[model samples]
Each structure stands twice: as structure tokens, then as C-alpha cells.
Target: MKILITGGAGFVGQALRRALGNAHTLTILDTAPAPADLGPSTRWIEASILDEAALREAFAGQQAVFHLAAALGVRACQEREDIVEQVNVGGMRAVIAAAVATPSVEHLLFTSSSEIYGDGEPGQIFREQDEPAPRSAYARSKIASEELMAAAAASPEGARLSYTVFRLFNAYGPGQRADFVIPAFCRAALQGEAPVVHGDGLQTRTFTFIDDIAAAMVSALDARAPAKAAGSLEVFNLVSEETLTIASLAQLVCLSAGERPRVLHRDHEDPAVGRSKRFEVTRRVADNRKARAALGFRPTTPLSEGVRRTLDSVRAGSGAAEARG
Candidate 1:
């Protein structure tokens, strides 16, 4: 299959590149310049997803499109909702429009975030059917994008565009950005600084490895798209069963670095901290049974192993750009 991944220069996109390997012809559309190690079968297009002409040109001759380009991170989204709206929401509109106009594009897969299922009750595992309670602007943008995708598929113009929405949980791995929890903890641990915890530190999240996320996403290509009442669409929670508190993850990262755990608790809402008060997801976990049965999605990396590898990558001077993706 000929595939096009928007924001393919990022960490998760690079993992998807590895997973796809030479099996498919891959084209990347991103604002970032092409990486030094571009694959033999991959082509890089340094363009923004919000550019309709660029999207139309990129969508040409592609069988599948992975929509991954967006303004990521809770803090970033909270700080600049304007840019987030432009990239996440407006960019999605461009992608959808381009895909609809393209004849060769059969499938459109979007990388939605698990943050949409905000503030779940204790032990509340989220399903695709669960109602979304988005907290931050980022989460709201994702929800809006998902709705747009669904609407496009259900529309008469988008009859040929079958779509999949992969609501990915906390993704952490070797090349991830330090802004995320795992890499941040590892970096702090290596630097002999206290692991910083936002909010009460008791907030829980299920971390999925980058490799596992890529695998699940690729598996969706071969899986059957069951008919839905709404449209020719499928939604899966690409997550692992491993769940932990923010405080525990910090401790784990510190211990993995062979140091005693020292945690620094910070107010997520403090203006001095430069974080959004809307970072309100107290507990976020997902039910991956649908993905397991439908896409054979099984996350193998344990949190300990993942943290160790992330630490190693950080110590080896892995750049932040890769992680930010």
C-alpha cells in the first residue's frame, strides 16, 4: 500500500516508519525538514497540513493517509489555543477535504488522543461507546476532529473514504519528547533533579509504548472495517493494560536510574508554572479489548522496560524534536 503520514517527522511517526519499513511506499508531510536518515521507500514533503494545495498534492496516488499532524501537548494547547485550533482543527478540515477529492485514497486513519475521555472515575475503563468529557483545548480539538472525520465518511461526498479513529493513550518510549511524563522523569533522574509531578501527583494514566502504538496502527490496515450505524468508520483505543499513578512513574524512573526517588509537586494551574489549569484528567484508562480482537493490538513493553529505554535514549543525547513528534 502507498501510505502518506502527516507529521511523519515526529517520534511516533518515525516509529510508524520503522513498522512500515519497505513494505509500503511512504510519503511524509510535515513542517519539519526531512530527517537525516530518510528511508529508501519514503518521500518527505516539508509542508503544513493546513495547506489545502499541499494536502491535495500529497493525497494524490495514496491508498491510505495517517492524519497525525497537530499541535500536541496539554501545556502547549492550553497556552496557545489559537494555534491549536488552526493546526488541529483547521488542518484536519484540509486533510479531509483533500482526501475526499482524491480518487485513490480509500482509507483515512486519524491519531486521536485518549485525553478525550477526560476525568474517568476510579477503575473506569473507557470504551469507544463512552461519552467524551474533554478537559483541555487539545482534547476538545481532537474530539472535534473525530467528529469531522465521522461526518465526512457519512456524507455523500466521502462515500469512498472509509476511516479509523485510533484513540491513543499516553505514549512513551526511547525517542519521545521531554515534555511528556516518562521522558521528563528520565531526564530529571539522569540530571539528579527531582522528578516533577503536576497537580496532586495521584492522577493516573495508562502508558503505551511507541512501538506498540505503531504496531496497532499498522494492524488496522488489514483489519476489516465493520459497518457502523453512523458510517463506514471504526474507533479503537490503542492502549496497554499497564496503569500507574504519576507519582509512582516518577519513583520508577528514579529507581531505574539507581537513585532514591525525590519528587517535586507543582501546581498545574499556577501561572508561574506556565501550565493550564484545565489539565484536569484525574484518571485516564481505556478498554483495549476492541483493538485486541479487531486489530490484534497487544502492547508488550512493561512500564519498567519502557522507562529504562527512555532513560538510555535521554542519556545518549536523543534530541527533543524526535520526542516532540
Candidate 2:
């Protein structure tokens, strides 16, 4: 199958390319330059999702399109609401306009985030059926994009679109930006610095490894995959079980990196910067029963193992970065 991965040079995009690149004809679309070390067989198209002409050309003769392009994180969206909305929400509108109309596009997998769940009900395993209560601009943008996909589902080309939305939980692994928790903690641990914690370190989240997320996406792309056509528009929560606290998580990263745990807790919630406003989800956990029953999605990587691999990657990356510097 011929696949086009938007944001193909991103952390998740690179991991997806590695997971599915060998088996399929892979084309990467992004504004950033293609990674220098990408495989020779991989095709790279440097362009933005907002480019209608480029979308028209890229969507032609594509079997599957992984729509992963978006503003990076909650903090980023908070800092640049206007630009992030255009990129996160508006980009979806543009992609749907271009992709759904393309006859060759059978399946378009969109990467949504669990942020849409917001500060969910007090004690509920966030299920697909639960009402979405978006808390921040980032979370709201995610829901907005999902609604756009829903709109496309009712459009004239709905049948041809075959859109799939995977609402991801906290995804982390190597190549992830250092701003994220795992990498940040890893860098701090490696440097023997006390990593700064955003809150009181009580908030919980389900962190899925990049490889597992890529594997799930690969499975979802398969036409005969068990997860296909569960509904006209399908949404799955891609995550692992929540098994650690932010404080524990910092310690775990230190342990993974073979360092002493000396985490510094702080409240980086600055209203002026909109950091607290954007990251409103105090605790995030999901129920994967729907995914398991339909997609046969079973996450295999344990936290300890995932952290070890991430630490290894962080170490390598920091070393390479230092060498370059």
C-alpha cells in the first residue's frame, strides 16, 4: 500500500515510518527537511498541510494517509493559540477537504489526543461513549478537529474517506521533544539535575511508548484489520494503564537512566503564559476495552522497559547533540 504521513519528520511520524516503512510505499510530507538518515526507499515531500495545491498533488493515488500534523503540545497551544488553532484545527479542515475527495484515499488515520477528555468525571474510565469535556484551548482544538472529521463523515465522499481517529494518551519515547516529561526527566537525570515538576506530582497519566503507538496505527491501517468499520466514524483511546505518579515517574526516569532521584517539584502554572489554562487535565486514564475488542490492540511494552529504551535513546541523543555542538 502507498501511505502518506503528514508531519512525517516528527517524533511520532519518524517512529511510524520505521514501523510501516518497510512493508509499504512510504511518502513523508512536512514543512521541515526530511531526516538525513531516513531510508533510501522513503519519499519526502517538504510542504505544509495548509498548502492546498500540495495537498491536491500528494493526495492523488494514495491508499492510506496518516494525518499526524498538528501543533505540538498543550504549552505550545497556550502560548500561540491563534497559530496553533490554524495548525491543529484549521489544518484538519484543509486535509479533509483535500483527502476525502480523493478516490484513492481509502483510510485516513487522524492522530487525536486524550486531552479532549479534559478534567473527566471524578471516577470514570474515559470510554469512547463518554461525553467530551475539553478544558483548555489545546483540548478544545482536539475536539474541534474530531468534529470536523465527524462532519466529513456525513459529507458526500464520506464512504470513500474511511477516516479513523485515534485519541492518544500521553505518548513518549526516543526522538520526542525534550519538553515532554520523559525526555525532560531523562535529560535532568543524566545531568544530575533535579527535574522541575509542573504540579504537586500527584497528577496521573497513561504513557504509551512510541513503538506501540506506531504498531497500533499500522494495524489500524490494514483493511482487514479487526478494528476496521466498528462504526461509520471510529475513535479509539491509545494508551497504557496508568501506573505511576509524576513524582514516581521522575524517579523511574532516573532509575531507567541509572541515576539518583532528586526531583524538584514546582508549580509552573503561570496564568500569564496560559500554561495552567492549557494543561487542565489533573488526572488522565482510559478504558481500552473498545480498542481491545475491535482493533485487537494490546500494548505490550511495560513502563520499566519503555523507560529503559527511552533513557538509552535520550543518552544517545544528548551525546550526539553534544558532539555536534
Candidate 3:
């Protein structure tokens, strides 16, 4: 199969590339320069998703499309909602238009965030059918994009396009940017700095490993098409069973690095801290039973083991850079 992945240079994109291996002819479309080590079966297109011409060109002759490009991160999106809307929503519109026009494209996979669940009460599990309570700009953008995907699939022009939406939970692992919680904690622990805990440190999230995310994404390619003759739209909650508090996650990272757990609690809205946004979701845990039954998705990594591996990878990467220098 020939696959075209938007934002293929990102953290999750690189992981998916590894999972794809040499099985598929891969084309990566991103603004970033192509990775020096990309496989022979892979080619890179340096462009933005908002470029309709570029999207059409990339979608040409492709059997599948993985739409991963977007303006990510809560704080970043909050600060620049306009850009978020432009990239997230506008990009999806462009991708759909291109896919609808393309003849060879069969399936399109979209990565939606679990942040759309908003602030759920403790023990409240988010299901696929649950109404979205998006609190932030980024979350709202994702929900909007999701609606666009469904609408596009049901459109007459998109009758042949099959689409899948994977509502991804907090995905953390090596190569994740430091702005994220897990990698931030790991970096602080490795640098001998106290991990910063925003708010009360009780905000909960279901952290899925990057490998599991990649595997589930790759498995979707083999999934059966929707029975509907016009088109098909499927939504699955892609997450692991592990749920942990922010403070607890910090402690786990410290322990993984063989360091004492010393955390620095700060107001999420504090400008001095200059990271987290004012509005933060209290709890977000998704029910993955539908995904388990439909896609045979079972996340295998435990929180402790995943944390250890992430820390080790960071250390190894730093050591390799030092050696090269």
C-alpha cells in the first residue's frame, strides 16, 4: 500500500514510520526537512497541510492518508487560537477536499485528542458516544475537525472515502517534545531539577505509549470497510488502561531516574511559570472497550515501564550527541 502521512516528521509520525517499516511505500509531507535516515521505501514532501495544491499533489497515487498535522499543545493553542483554527480546522478541510478529489485514495485516518472530553468528574469514564465538553481552544478545534471529517465522508463527492477517527489519549514516550508533561518531568529529573507540578497536581490522564499508538494506527489499514455503500465513518478511543495523577507521574519519573522525588507546585496561570494555561482539565479517562473489540487494540505497556524506557531513551540520545560532538 502507498501511504501519505501529513506531519510525518513529528514525534508520533516518526514512531509510526518505524512501525510501518518497509511494508508500505510511505510519503511524508511536512514543513520540516526530511530525516536523513528515512528508508528507501519512504519519500518526503516539504509542504504545509494548508496548501491545497500541495495536499492534492501528495494525495496523488496514495492508497491511504494519515492526517496528523495540526497546531498542538494546550497552552500554545490557547495563546494563538486563530492559528490553531487555521491549521487544525482549515488543514482538515483542505485534506478532505484533496482526498475527495483524489481517485486512488481509499482510507483516511485522523488523530483526534482526548482533550475534547473536557473536565470529567472523578471515576467518570469518557466513551465514544459521550458528548464533548471542550473547554479550551485546541479541544474545540479538534471537535470541529471531527465534525468536518464526518460531514465530508457523508458528502456525495466523498462517497468512496472511508474515514477513521482515533480519539487519542495523552500519548507520551521518547522523542515527545519537552512541552508535554511526561517528557518535561523526565527532563527535569535528568537535569537534577525539581519537576514542576501545575495546579493541585491531582489532574488525571490516561497515558498511552507511542508504540501502542503506532500499532493501533497501523492496524487500522487492514480494518474492514464500512458496510455502507456511500462511505464509512468510525471513531475509536485509542488509550491505555494506566491512569495517573500529575504529581504521581512526576514521582514515577524521578524514581525511574534513581533520584529523590522533589516536586515544585505552581499556579497554572502564573506568568512566571510561563507554560500551562489558566484552564486545565481535571480528569480525562476514556473507555477503550469499543476499540478493543473492533480493532483488537490492547495497550501492553505499564506506566512504570514506559516511563523507564522514555528516560533511558533521552539519556541515550544525549550521550550519543555528546559522543558525536
Candidate 4:
């Protein structure tokens, strides 16, 4: 398929490029110019998603669009609300508009977040039927974007566009930014420095591997349209069934680093403060039944194995950095 992926230079984008390189013609659009290492089959365009003309140009002749570009990172979004709103919401508007305008585009996948679930009860797993109670500014922005995409899909103009929304959980693996929990812990542990654990480290999360996420995305893109056709919009939760506490994750990182490092419990307040203590994702386990029934989606990697692979990649990258220095 001829595919256009926005934010195609980011971590997940890089993985997608590596995974789909040989099979598909790929074009990447980002605010920054294309990196020097982009593959020969891939074309890069320098433009933000907010630019309607640029987005239109990028959408031309593409059979599918993967709208992965967004202002991400909880901490970063907490600090820059205005920029997050503009890039996350405004940019999505432009992308959806361009995709609907282009007659050749068959499928458009918008990457949403599990944070839209906000603070659920500790034992309850979030499902598609559950109401969204967004807490943070970032979550609110994502919720807004999802609504926009749904609205666009329902419109008469969007009849030809197939829409799939993925509510991604905590995705971790190599090439992820160091600001996130896993990478941050890995870097600190490797340096023999105490890793910081915020908020008593009791928060539990389902960390989805990057490879699984990419696989799910590909499946969602290729799924057949439903027969009833209320515009054929589907939402899937992309995640692993395993839920690990932050404290346990920290210890695992220490073990991976081959060192028992100190964990400093910082008093940093959660952005979703006073909202809820524990999120009960009882159904936190992704009911891949919907996805599997529709698009042969299955998560193959175990959590421990994925973590080991991530640690290995981090160590290798660290070694490279040391050699360069």
C-alpha cells in the first residue's frame, strides 16, 4: 500500500518504517526535515500537520494515512498546554480535513491514548463502551481529537474514508524518548545513579511493546469495513494484559542494569491530583476479540521478554554513546 505516516520520524514511526519498509511505499511528514537515515523507498516532507496545504500535498496519491503526530509526554503537556492544544487538536483537524478531501485515501488511523480513561476504579478495565473522563490537559486534547475524527467520519463528505482509532496504553521500547519512565530508569540505572520514582511508585500501568502496537496498527489499517456502515468507525485498545506497578518496574530496571540501585521517592504530584488513587482497569486486558474477529490482531510478546529486549537496546545505545565520547 502507498502509506503516508505523520510523525514518521518519532519512536513508533521509526519502528513502523523498519517493519513496513520492504512491503509498502512510505511517505513521512513532520515539522522537522527528514532525517539522513530515511530509507530509499521513503519520501520525507518538511511541514507541520497544521498546514492544510502541506497536508493536502502529502495526502495526494496515498492509499492510507496513519495520523500518529501529536504533542505527547504527560510532563511536557503539563508544561505547555497552549502548544499541546494547538498541535494535538489543530493539527488533527488539518489532517482529517485533508484526508476527507482526498478521494484516493481509503483508511485513516488516528492514534489516541488510554489516558482518556482518566482515573478509573482500581479493578475496572477500560472498555470502548466506558465514558471518557479525561483528567490532564493532554488527555483532554486527545479526547477532543478523537471526537473530531469521529465527527468527520460520520459526515457525508467522509463516506469514502475508513477510520480506525487506537487507544494506546503505555507504549515502551527502544528509540523511545529518555523523558519517559522506562528509558529514564534505564539511563539512570546504567549510570549507577539513583532512579527517581514519583508519587510513591504505586501507580500501575499496562506497558504495550512498540512492536505489538505497530502490528495492531497494521491490522487496524487492513480490516474490512463492517456491513452496516454507520461510516465504519472502530476503536480498539492496544495494550498488553500484564499490569505492573511502577515500583516493581523500577526494580526490574535495576536488575536489567546488573546493579541494585537506589530509588528515590520524589514528592512530585500527579497531574491528575485528587482525582483517584488507583485506576481499576479490571478489563485493562485488551479484549483483542473485537480486533481479532475483525482484523486478526494478536499480541505475541511477553512483558518480561519485551523488557529484556528494551534493556539490551538501551545498553547498546549507551555503549555507542560512550564510544563516541
Please, what is the whole-model Cα lDDT of each candidate in the order they appear? 0.87, 0.81, 0.88, 0.79
Residue 252 error for model 4, in Å? 1.2
- lDDT by residue (1-325, candidate 4, tens digit) is 8899999988888877776857899989988778877778889998888877788889999988899898886656877999999999998888888888888888888889888887656677777767998767788999999899889878999867778888888888988987787888888888887777766777778888899888878766556432333366788888777887787888888887787846877655555332233332222333455665665666778777777788788889989988999
User: Of models 3 and 4, which has the larger lDDT?
Assistant: 3
Ten contiguous residues minimizing lDDT sum, candidate 3: 223-232
Model 2: per-residue Cα lDDT over 131-155, one tens digit each: 9887677888889998988888777
Give me the overall lDDT of model 1: 0.87
Model 3, residue 134: distance off in Å is 0.8
On lDDT, the candidate that comes out on top is 3
Q: List ranges where model 4 is wrong by over 4 Å.
A: 225-230, 269-287
Cα RMSDs, all models:
3.2, 2.4, 1.6, 3.3
Residue-by-residue lDDT tens digits, candidate 3, 264-313: 99987788778655467888898999988878888999989999989988
Instruction: Write one digit per residue (lDDT tens) for candidate 1, span 100-198.
Output: 888888888999999888888977889999999888889999999999998998899996667999998998898887677788889899888999888
Candidate 2: worst-modelled 10 consecutive residues by lDDT: 223-232
Candidate 2: segments with Cα more than 4 A from true spot: 223-231, 270-274
On TM-score, the leading prediction is 3
Q: What is the TM-score of candidate 2?
A: 0.93
Question: In candidate 3, how many Å is residue 262 off?
Answer: 2.2
Quote the lDDT for 202 in model 1: 91
> What are the runs in model 1 whose C-alpha is more than 4 Å off?
224-231, 270-272, 318-325
